[model samples]
Target: MNEERIIELEIRQAYQEDLLQALNSVVAEQQKQIGKLEETCKLLHDKLKSLARAEPSPGLADERPPHY
Candidate 1:
């Protein structure tokens, strides 16, 4: 093989390695974000469930709408 051809091949390989590393980093970050999102969703679900089960304070029904 010619020297130029060998150099080109090496450059291409380096680029491929860098691309793979970046992709892996992106995937790791995405996985972490997904975990956080799942926890947040669960917390929101629990809060909504508690609010649904809790009784309202007395006279809440007496609040007037802006149309009033």
Candidate 2:
């Protein structure tokens, strides 16, 4: 009986170890994706800021037409 119990415990441990490894892999992949998304967001933000700088301010474009 004791030997059977030991075998059962060993099986459970093996399964647990496999599950832990799979979960760790998933977490690592998610972190990599998150890093990529963060880089993309930063690049887009910088591009928007540069574009805003290149454009005219709000009131400048709304002036009366030359026909006035």
Candidate 3:
């Protein structure tokens, strides 16, 4: 009985180890994707800011059309 219990424990440990490794890999990939997304967001924000700066301020030039 003791030997059987030991074997069962070993099997459980092995499965746990495999699960832990899989979880670690998934987390690492998610982190890398998050980093990439953050970089893209920053670039888009900067481009928008630059475009806003280059555009004319709200005034006669930006009036709505007569249809509106």
TM-score of each: 0.73, 0.79, 0.84
lDDT of 3 by residue, 1-68 (tens): 99999999999999999999999999999999999999999999999999989995788768898999
Query: lDDT of candidate 3 vs native?
Result: 0.96
Overall lDDT per candidate, in order of appearance: 0.93, 0.95, 0.96
Best-to-worst order by lDDT is: 3, 2, 1
Per-residue CA lDDT of model 2 for 3-58, tens digit only, reads 99999999999999999999999999999999999999999999999998999567
Candidate 3, TM-score vs. the true structure? 0.84
Candidates ranked, most accurate by TM-score first: 3, 2, 1
lDDT score, candidate 1, position 24:
100
After the best TM-score superposition of candidate 1, give how far the Cα of residue 20 lies from its true spot, in angstroms. 0.9
Model 1 C-alpha lDDT per residue in residues 1-68, reported as the tens digit of each score: 69999999999999999999999999999999999999999999999889877965457678787788
lDDT score of residue 5 within candidate 1: 100
**Greater-lDDT candidate between 1 and 3:** 3
21 Cα displacement, candidate 2 (Å) = 0.7
Better of 1 and 3 by TM-score: 3
Q: With candidate 2 superimposed using the best TM-score fit, by how many Å does residue 57's alpha carbon deviate from the native?
A: 4.9
